[model samples]
Target: MTNMASYTDPTVKHDALLLFEAVDSNPNGDPDNAGKPRTDLETGHGLVSDASLKRKVRDVVQFQVDEGMLSPADRYQIFIRRGVSLNAQLEDAYGALGQATGKGAKADFVAKSAEYMVARYFDVRMFGAVMSTGNASAGKVTGPVTVGIARSQDPVLPIDMGITRTASTQEEKKDNASQMGNKSVVPFGLYVCRVHYQPTRNNQVSEEDLQVLWTSMANMFELTRSAARPDISVRNLFVFSHSTSLGNAPARKLFDSVTIAKVSDLDLPRTSTDYTVTPPAAKSLPDGVTLTTVV
Candidate 1:
């Protein structure tokens, strides 16, 4: 169960590191590049967008709700759900207050509506959103959580393989052979992502919320399996907790404590054992800070 009371406290900061691997899968595809895996042109390393990771977290939340693990009144709704109209969702806020939404609405009404949105939607409270769209403008929130783009530690080679389907949908293809298609994948890759949570942004994130987020990150790959991304897994998760609201040490310094290197000079690594990761020592950690590994 989530501890709802901690959400009101405005003095908690967190930093986390997520290490994951993809085996013969496209972790994230670039629609602009013919659905190929996104990669850095200079470094040749694979890239996974923050949106992709956040979508996985959102899916986990939705799955939990669908399985009756959470209730609608628990204030854990998703605002950016598929096939749902944003205006319709916004209208519900006004409807709850027995009022209409428009340009002429008072400032207090807009503020209250924005607050209501932050309280009702988990994504809004976690990642924030620009609610200025649609008829009902409830303003905006900065949120507290921020996830950076994930990048492979070593260079990766993206391979595009030709695929074919035996069945055809059109009658014109009755005499035709299999339809040709393309599938892109990276032989193997180890990606690392940085995450930050600032309590002062909106003061809406609770201790339980952080716990849920950690769990979501650890299990997102398992829940988001598909042909494009079949063998994605989280290898490590490092969470850095600060005693103060701002932070006790520099994030970059803390991140530098975790180092990753290849075990051998293999042209292409296939397994996680091919790499070695060194996490920070507990005794050497900065004062007023602690580390926790979830995976």
Candidate 2:
């Protein structure tokens, strides 16, 4: 874990490019369409939402805390958590300070509460949040780290297959019977996601925070296992750190420098080995910028 104090710098900006692959797994499910894998209707390309990716990162951080890798008072709490009420958390925040958790709370108090939330929640500090619920409103913080939606390098084939279980859960089954179910999967896909860190946004994301973010992305799929997603892995992670907060080069240009292509002979690709990745040369990088690759 990186020292928490290291993230207080407010003038360091960063851009990252990630390449990952999924095999026979549903990376992101679409609730609008019966929990199927999300896809582009016209192009058939698989889609993984930025929220989904961020959730994975958050899960990793939470897991670290659970494993005692982080301390309780480390100010790395999770704001958007599962099985927890936002209002309840907000009330607790005010209660801790012996302040009224109501809409009529003083403006300065609200501002202070918001700062408290930022200091307590790692996600809030790095990704920002809208801490307004009921009588308690801590306002909003625009997180410094921004993640873009991930898309496959090529169009993916979504396959729906039927499954069955011989054992039934209910006592109503007198005899051994089978349970029927269906699941969706992508045969294979390599996805690309972009991440940006704006130092001027919150001045909360430090070099250590960025390292944790990278580690989270690199190992997210491996640690978060499920029947629906079992074979996803990170293939490449490219980071571009600029010396100045404003940055020296365009983000798109930096992204365009890296190229990924499938093997010319393979009609259908099933793994990361089937593709070739071309990263830009270090000398080609713009002045006042450094690149790091973690694969």
Candidate 3:
């Protein structure tokens, strides 16, 4: 692939920073804690899991395929999607290869099934999967991309508000007019997530795939609005592309170059403007590394 501002070589190493903000929303709710925002009790910092972020990315890609925006739809199908049976999908792979599990057939069937999955599923190629769960087993593939958990820059306050519904579900209890519920929200927060991409010879990750990934990430929240998360958005997407597949600098070094600090004047950050974001200086980057602002 040629060097460019937005699209870079998919085979090379990549480090990215995603800075997003949430206003009056629960970015990610911890069901374990009564559907409240996940947080570090020791530090009060809000948390958003890597799995949640990837699910958003996967949803965006699935939307694209559903709308016929992505051509050759079979190539971008989602494997870990909702309402889909994993074992059934694995069986399809074996059927496609005309192979049945029998004596001495396990190894060959697993190999071909994994390859078939890599070719058909976009998430498997980018985020990887473990398909060795059921009788129809396809070995796992280490994906090229990995996302880290997102952490808020400052401590967040989760406010649980009591809500009421005017109508009751049961007709027998019509006189029990109002029902009580709870809503969880964060007044405001700024979160940063780190992601890395390293191409391996086993999977097929193309330049077009990378482009779609970036596009989906940038708009991950646009079409995913809900009552619980109506004000979440991507504020910045910084991608550092390395010239060589091995990478010219450690990912930590590249990530540290970009700083996100709260403004001195703000006692509590309530909006994105309360914090200042600084991208890595082009001249300060190591040789053979280029930074691109995809968002």
Q: Largest lDDT belongs to which candidate?
A: 3
- Model 3 scores a C-alpha lDDT of 0.89
Q: Say which prediction, candidate 1 or candidate 3, comes out ahead on TM-score.
A: 3
TM-score of each: 0.94, 0.93, 0.96
lDDT of 3 by residue, 1-295 (tens): 2256334577689999999999999999998999999999999999999999999999999999999999789999999988999988987888898887433447866888898999899999999999887777888888999999999988999999999999999999999989999999999999999999998875498888998998899999998899999999999998999987899999999999998887776778899988889997789989998898887
Better of 1 and 3 by lDDT: 3
State which candidate, 2 or 3, has the greater TM-score.
3
lDDT of 2 at 250: 90
Which lDDT tens digits does candidate 2 get at residues 1-295?
A: 1233222234767788999999999999999988899999999999999999999999998888778876553677888888999988888889877897677888888888888888889899889899876677787788888999999998998999999998887888948578889999999999999999887644655555666777787888878779999899898988777778898899998999998878787878888889999888889989977777766
* Candidates' C-alpha lDDT: 0.85, 0.83, 0.89
Per-residue alpha-carbon lDDT of candidate 1 for residues 133-181, written as tens digits (9 for 90 to 100): 8778888888888999999988899999999999886988777758899
Off by over 4 Å in 2: 1-10, 71-73
**True-vs-predicted CA distance for residue 148, candidate 3, Å:** 0.5
At residue 261, give the lDDT of candidate 2: 79
